[model samples]
Target: MKISILTSLLILLSLAAQTSPVLKIKFDDIESGNIFLINVQKELTDTLSINNGKVTYEAKIAAPTFFYLIVDGYNNTRPLELVLSSQLTEMKFESYKVVGENTVNEAYPNSPIFISDPNNNIAFFEFLSHWKSFYNTIQALSENDSEEQLEKRKNTYHTFLSTNKQIIENNSDQYVSAKMIDFLLNNNLLQFETLQTYYDLLSPKVKESYLGFKIGEKSGKAGQLQPGKPAPEIALVDIQGKKYSLQSLKGKNVILHFWSSSCAPCIKEAPDLLKLQQGNTENLVVINFSLDTDNSKWKKGIERAGIEEMINVCDLQGYNSVTAKSYDVTFIPVYYLIDANGNISLKGTLSQITEKIKEDMP
Candidate 1:
């Protein structure tokens, strides 16, 4: 009986994996298909809201979609409903409020469009188009991957980000588009590349905002760092009472990794990193920064992931670290590999290029 029940459970799990999810949200004035957070009491789960009433998700969305949503962000308050028919799948979004109101109030800057809804349109659709393309590319790379699938994902993501960079003029808004562009270069280019006239296009205020800024101070001007520039430095306290300087490791190769207890990917990558470290102790030094402000969670993550020997470090400032600001890091489980000379050697998805490091370092 026990063996049979275990087998049955496995079968059920497999079936769940194969199923595409359909959701019904009984909220009004929210017809958008933009993904959002689902609140069961106070905690959050993966959910998408209808930006316009009649829309279909058809696939899963990025996790940051949920973060922005939990903070009551992403989609503006618009009415939404589900439309299902026997023969086809489709969506329809309608406008709400007056014409001036039709455009998102300048207050609702993060609001998505109601598709054909007028009055709120900007000339920035090119940026929007590329961002959606990049996000979808990332969404497709979810754990189900064979060798062929992996190649296709990386190539597709690289090309999408590369082509899309042209549409982004400068660091004007430093929102989602800017984040996407940085992710692309850090992951694909390994360093920021300059396009002609990019600096000229940006005003002096945008370029000089970081001179005396605090760690968490954000503006509309975050972009990739220039060549030979020192990586962003930080003063952080570890599990011990000792404080450390991020810039002190000027003459060494440093692997700046960010993680938290809540992330499964962060957990999975820990062992791989330890093994990598043991093998490359001569050139590789890891400075892991945790986003978890909760010390219990931070300690639990370190214990559970078995990274005790790793120079596990954090400022306990969560998102307000000077390094995070300098690099504009928006997500966890990311790392920046700086060369011995203090220039950014590699950036972007760490797992994507682990083998490259293994080959070079070994």
Candidate 2:
């Protein structure tokens, strides 16, 4: 009778362990610090304490989800992204720097080597690697619009698209495919139809994943703000608590400048934008809608850029702002030109928008 009771207790414990998802992470050189785990899908952050160079996280996950791990006191290191599952996943990392006298410096690998990943996180990292490679190649190319340079850029972009499509096709059954599709969609790399196609090719299990649902939602919202559609209303307050709305600025050609303080490209285009607004004050209104979460930083960015003359507004919700979602803004430095009739005339980069303005307003 005693043996049978003990066996029953052991089986119950095993069943309980199997039902819970666990993640165990070990750092080789780091001893103790607070690590923040950010759930990408839910936008929730949890602080986990590290004891003796290790930390363990346990949660009931519906599906494989993406998370960002930010190490405390590592100001220079970017947040590490990982895909986690509802199964036991173990990971080890060399937290300290390999070269230089400052071993604890900010320079670190983009991602850590996973000791054990039950949920195809390794493949997700490979997808990110490919994206980084393509981005670097494009960034290194000449910026001139010469025929040869333009052709090279076109070929490079097409090649990247093809490579990403192949990767998604090869791993259609994996959760990483959903992540890859999400990345492409967020970056505005794929068209609406192509995004739908890639999403359709995903396995049914992957399509039911958390990221897959998010991709479906994003795709549904895509192309809603096309050139001919009515521009969505944006109501928000500026840094000084001054309220502004797109409806109030009607009957004038409006330039909805979606940006953030952290985006370098946005800051770089501030001067040009300021000039454009100044030159066309009678017919043009440039609304600088900032996606900054911090109030102080938003004020400072505007002051530093010296665009105090233009109308500025922010809701301090960052990407979660309703204005951002209504416009389907996933990337930074996006510009939209709403004509006098309050219709979206064009949406593109600053240069493209500038050319359109010149052609239409002239």
> What's the lDDT for all of these models?
0.51, 0.77
Query: What TM-score would you give candidate 2 relative to the actual structure?
Result: 0.56
Cα lDDT tens digits, model 1, 132-240, are: 5666666667667566766777687568646655554543333223333333433432222132223333334434423212111222123444335666666766677
Q: 1-362 in candidate 2: lDDT tens per residue? A: 35698899999898765545368988888889888999998999989999999999978786788888787766324666677878878878875443333432222353666777787677767777777777777666656746687667768877988887888888888888888888777675765446667878889898788888766655443346767789888777765677766677778999989887756568888999998988898999888999889988998889878888778898888878898889877767778899888898987677878899999989
Question: Could you tell me how far off, in angstroms, the CA of residue 26 lies in candidate 2 after the best superposition?
Answer: 1.9
lDDT of 2 at 247: 79
Where does the lowest 10-residue lDDT sum fall in candidate 2? 98-107
Question: Each candidate's TM vs. the true structure?
Answer: 0.43, 0.56
